[model samples]
Target: MALREQLDADMKTALREKDSLKLSTVRMIKSAMKYKETEPGAAGPLDDAGILQVITSEIKKRRDSVTEYEKAGRSDLADKEKAEIAVLQHYLPEQLTAAELEKAVADAIAEAGAEGPRDMGKVMKVLTPRIQGRADGKVAADLVKQKLAT
Candidate 1:
């Protein structure tokens, strides 16, 4: 099923189960997707990859919120954000393990002929699409840096 259909089905299930957290998170994601659809020059409905991109962006926002809440010593709010992250994560592809990510970065570096830190851009250009929503950009970049530095 398409992401739209899947989300709709899940939203109905959440409603039936009276899962307030899940209902709110699904609504938030739906709102974001609606905004994307209405954006200037948007080509109408988003494909699976586009939906995944949106989901990933939402996850990132929740993670940032969690960090801010933690720093402000609001464990309550941080826990909420973490819960939202967990709910949203169900739609995303399985994340790459550290070793898998390392291998992917190494492969990109080799394929891009990236020999030094200066070639980071080249490696990232070749690597980003492959990892996409499956890996955290910051973690993958750090891994790339570690590999390059060695």
Candidate 2:
């Protein structure tokens, strides 16, 4: 089934099971997705990749919140953000391990012929799609810089 259908089904399940956190998270995702579908230029219902894009963006926002909450000494809010992250993460592709990410970055650098930090753009262009939603952009960029500078 398409992600939209899956979300609908999950929403029902969350309701039936009284899973408030999951229900809210799913509802938030569905809301974003519905907005996307009805947006002026949308062609049709979202494909899996499109749905994943929305989920990934949501997760990124939650991660930022987690960081901010932690910095502000609000463990309660940070914990909630972490819980939301856990729920949202189920929709993402498996994350790359440190070794896997390092290897992939090296390959991207080589493929893009990136010889130095100045070539970061070229390497990122080649790398971003390959690792999308699988690796954090900041981590990937840091790894790329480390690899390129050596």
Q: Which candidate comes out best when scored by lDDT?
A: 1
The digit string of per-residue lDDT tens for model 2 on 47-81 reads: 88889888988988999999999999999999999
Candidate 1: tens digits of C-alpha lDDT, residues 7-86? 99999999999999999999999999989989999999988889988999999999999999999999999999999999
**Residues forming the 10-long window of minimal summed lDDT in candidate 2:** 1-10
Query: Model 1 segments beyond 4 Å from truth?
Result: none
Q: TM-scores across all candidates? A: 0.96, 0.91
Span of 10 residues, lowest total lDDT, candidate 1: 141-150
Q: Estimate candidate 2's alpha-carbon lDDT, on a 0 to 1 scale.
A: 0.91
**What shift in Å separates residue 78 of candidate 1 from its native position after superposition?**
0.5
Off by over 4 Å in 2: none
